[model samples]
Target: MESKELINKSAKKIWQKWSIAIRITPLIILLALLKILTHYLGWEVLELNALFTSLVAGTIFLIGFLISGVLSDYKESEKLPSEISASMKSLVDDTYTIYKTKNTLTALEFIEFQKMFCNSLINWFYKKEKTKVILKKISEMNHFFIELDKEGVQAGYIIKMKNEQNNLRKMILRIDTIRDTNFVDSAYTILEAMGFLIGCCLLIIKIEPFYASLFFTLVVTFLIAYMFLLIKDLDNPFDYSSNGESGTEVSLKPIHDLRKLLIDFI
Candidate 1:
């Protein structure tokens, strides 16, 4: 059951229905047209079937290695939203704890701060703004703790909440590192060239029954192109979708759960 759920999530993230097909369609069409031309013109120039097999095996091995590395990062990313959410919830809970005992922390202010920070962070995902803005908002939370300290709230409580805030900052920076950098960028270029060369090899190689060549050409071209695109998207696990959109982004359910806790607390 757990495996099935991960499969479902991964499938959605990798393909997202029409988007995958649309991106690969051009590559497919080019390969298909080349396949047909070779057939009609009877232009089987030095069959590459034996060499093609070796090339494919090598390409697959390389792609698998790169994908495993990317997948490790992605699997780690799947846990981050929950981590951030839990950390954020602790802050809210701390505020609640302080408010209940000392009656000094402002509930309204914390609620507003949570809402603003969440919205801003999502906007950053959407490429609408810079992360510095979000970082600044996080720093602003220190003011609340400062006020708490002044109110004679226990120093331990204030320090703990401050620590939680720092953890949140660390997680966000970790996210920034993943989201901003591509893994094995040089390898991507090599694989892209390899995929193209493999497609060319498929186009030229003649097999028993011209239809067999055509079938393999289309299928192989599509698979290679699709996997390349999927891996590219997988690199950006936090590629969150907006307003009922489906995408390859890792699930943000924990973040939403934290939001619910805040709303209910309010």
Candidate 2:
């Protein structure tokens, strides 16, 4: 799988839908309670207060979800543009390859063959765009095996291929940096804002005094910041972390599997 798809698939497997539902359910309940109170509360002496509570509470919940949805859409869109670029390049390559390989045939037969080949190329490009991009990219890598005999003074030859270790390392580092510098997946930030808004709403209803709400709000804010920091530390899965390194093992495992196949073929 391509790196983006692989990470997405892994995320799907790791993060179940039920878990997400559970996390959001509490927030939904809290918002619902605020809505009910604002609509039904006795307003003989506090008509303005009831109006203010409904307006502010509804605004906060709406803003939070809207922000979350926008961020999610942006993240998904960013990935597709890159994939489309890679696939377009591969389609051009395939078409050119077919056109260059001329063979003798009848005039009608040759025309039919040309159409068939072009159609096949188009289908191949469309159906396997992600795999084609990965394959095409790796195929162009300048790989070489430098064998070292007794003395390591360039004793043996360098068997060069398109795929090179340097290229793979560079690609891995780019992905590593993306994961490291991710300010997008700020789940804790969302949670913190939600907590503070909830606290403020409670203070409005006299459930807690404004001073107590302020203190609790600060505590929730700090906790959210700390949790995000923890997630950021883990986001760079390629880097060594408290749990261990992420991509290192998977990267080498593929090389070993390829070596095994080559040995069997030989």
Candidate 3:
């Protein structure tokens, strides 16, 4: 078990490193490809006018812009999980406060419900499966609040708790939508095509130093692949796994901390 844990930890570290590297891999690849093209053109091995240089530079600029857009999308994606976590933590705290003040449910019952709701939430965040189960659990929580409302709990407190629950549900739904959405698909397709075109351009160059051309081509290819993998991995930050393990995921530390707080409250 220890060995397995160690391997999992190592794999997570590697994934994190690769994830960071992939963000810039496309630009690096493009520069390297351009450098090779420039060298061959300068050596007169590949006959092309200044027009070709301008075109290559333009293409690099365009691709760099696309990468920037992708990075923007990635940053947006990173915010969502934290948003959900915050909403959840607030909901948990608010629920506990309501329970304490209203006395609609016994401590044991509130704890039991809290445990079930929180467990379902964490599972939903991590497993991202069993939506029916999560929805059902949420319905149960909502129903519990409704029951409290009927039992002479202050309408204001009940309304606040319900609103928190609704916000939590909406955030969860947003997360699910994000998980299903493909933010980077179009960007990736464009990048892949550009990479292919670049590769073709490289192949056409009649450089005498065939090995150098070949080396540069390989590097560009690898870099393009790296970019694709990186974008895909980052597109849905919640869904990626390197070794089919869970720890490489976006940190659920906020939720975990909330869980501890819930335990303390109980």
Question: For every model shown, what is its TM-score relative to the native structure?
Answer: 0.87, 0.31, 0.70
lDDT of 3 by residue, 171-243 (tens): 6777677667776566667766776676566656655566776675566556555655655655565663332
Candidate 1 lDDT, 1-266, residue by residue in tens: 99999999788666566676787798788878878998789776758556778888888888788889899998988888888888888887877777777766464477578777876766776768787887888999988877777778888988898898899899888898998899989999999999988887777777878888788889878887888888887888876644233556777778776666666565
Which tens-of-lDDT digit does each residue in 1-266 have in candidate 2? 69999998687555532333344446545644554454356311222257655654554564455455445433543353244333333333332333344221222232333334333322332333333444444343221112111223121122211123234334534544443465454554665565566445443443234345345434443443333333444343333233232321112233233334323321
Best-to-worst ranking by lDDT: 1, 3, 2
Q: Which window of 10 residues has the lowest lDDT sum in candidate 2?
A: 142-151
Cα lDDT over the full model 3: 0.64
lDDT of 2 at 169: 36
- By TM-score, who's the top model here? 1
Q: RMSD, each candidate, Å?
A: 4.7, 15.7, 5.9
Q: What TM-score, to 2 decimals, does candidate 1 have?
A: 0.87
lDDT per model vs. reference: 0.79, 0.38, 0.64
Q: What does the lDDT come to for candidate 2?
A: 0.38
Clashes of each: 0, 4, 0
